[model samples]
Target: MIALHDAVGRLSAALGGSPAAKLAASALVEADALGLPRFGIAMLDEWAADAAPVPETAGAQAVSWLDCSSCFAPLAVAGTTLDLAGTARQSGIAAVFLRGVRGFGRLVPFVRHLADTGLVGIAGAEGPPFVAPHGGTRPVIGTNPFALAMGRGSERVVIDIASSSATMADIKTARMTDAPLPDGIALDGAGRPTRVAADVAALLPRGGQIGSLLGLTVELLAGVAGAGRGDAKGRGVFILAFDPAAAGEGIDWQGKLAALKSDWTDGGGYWPRGGALAAGTMLDGDFAQRLDTHLARMAGQAGC
Candidate 1:
């Protein structure tokens, strides 16, 4: 398994990043090291694609208070990710509309942090239009990813997903495995179905037509809602945090959720980390080697 510190050092040196960037990068690598993620690729591509731009602070116009707050941040997503959690702590429920942000990375880690801070998080983001439309060939909408996380006593559960049938990262990873695509996962450059990952040019939607609908819906919520002035920079995410105690359920609300989870498991079975832990992470040598080479290249570019 890749040590978390090593991953952080490599990513930080590669990006010349902030603490938040380093933390997010480390999580991305760890997730990939564990397995091919159901969500997508690590944020390293976004970071290494270009040197990080100077962050644009959220001016007063950034905050718009209605039932919650919306922040238009044309900058990094990490600080705002934490800021929303704190806002929830004070506001009972807070929404952060992060516009023009990049390197959204993994939602699980972000929401897990919010959960640890005693909050429930709902988040989504829009990235470059890498997926072709449901009935069309050319790319149009983003993968449209979302995540939900909640705290349960001393435990936390995070669920993350991308609306595409398979993410761009999935195709790239599949290339490494030399595996054929599933029945309806991707389309080739010629707009025909292809099983070979390397030949695939665009991804299809998840759940067939349903994923198509949901993908657009996600963009509406996370992308259009907090529409930014500039580019997505490969990542534009929005997150909302809610304080469960705001419902006047008291501090034991997490206990209630945890108990419900136990009941669900007792009834039959559920895939959650309530009392169990994952089998130890088994690092893939090829993945680690390729990842290291890419990071080393970025670091060299950064003069690290």
Candidate 2:
């Protein structure tokens, strides 16, 4: 196991000392800590090399639109979502329609950041077409994921899931480890079911038509966010945040939440949340070695 701070420091050094680098480093480490290592520091160089795009912002009422011109920097995407927490606080509710970006990692961290601020956050993203519609062959939809976070501080609930049976990152990790995917998770170019991750041309939706419907929902939401027709090289992201205190529920929401927690616990259900790694968290030997090798290569390239 590799210490969290050690991983962050190495990633930061490899990416440089820019503020954006630090943000990406921290988010990537959080990904590993949250048990989503497929989206973690493994792709540090890929993320760091992608420059942040400039978005044309258009704001009206409690909503805003950010039309980025090209590919996204993970840093800019996360930074923008963090900025929206303040907007939600002021407006009680706020939303942003994002388009013309790609390669942002997991949506969990973004919404989790909002939930930490005592706001309810909802986010969905449509990625490159990597999944097929129900009962159809060929790629037509992304491994779209939706995420929602609610509650305050340590007491929170978070839901983040992809509509596809498997995510692109999962495939990448499978390939990296030379591991075969579970049966029925993906299809080859001819749309036949296959377990070999390397031959995966597209993914199957979770629960057949039901998950297809969710993917359709994400696509339509992206369309509403101003994405264009045809193959989507970039991605569309939807983010909405609201201050729960503004809901006019006429009750102590936090206290009620605590009561609900008690009941949930008594029922053997635990609160669902993602968090930073414990101080003792460490990376395994293989991943730690990978990090060291990548960092050394980067340093050598820079003649350091």
Best by lDDT: 2
Lowest summed-lDDT stretch of 10 residues in model 2?
47-56
**Which ten contiguous residues of candidate 1 have the minimum total lDDT?**
65-74
Question: What is candidate 2's lDDT per residue for 1-304, written digit by digit as tens?
Answer: 7887888787776676555456667777777677666777665455423444445355534787666544334665665676688789999998876776655567877887788788989988887788999898788878788889888655577887788998887898898988878987889999999888889899999989999999888887765554622424567788899998886778678888778877888999967675545667777786777778777766766663
Clash number for every model?
A: 2, 4
> What lDDT is obtained when candidate 2 is compared to the true structure?
0.74
Alpha carbon lDDT at 200, candidate 1: 89
Q: After superposing candidate 2 on the true structure, give the runs of residues whose Cα lies further than 4 Å from its correct spot.
A: 6-23, 34-37, 47-61, 69-72, 169-183, 188-200, 223-233, 268-270, 284-304
Q: Which residue pairs show backbone clashes in model 2?
A: 1-282, 1-283, 2-282, 2-283
For residues 204-240, what per-residue lDDT tens digits would candidate 1 score against the true structure?
8887778888777778776677673125333456778
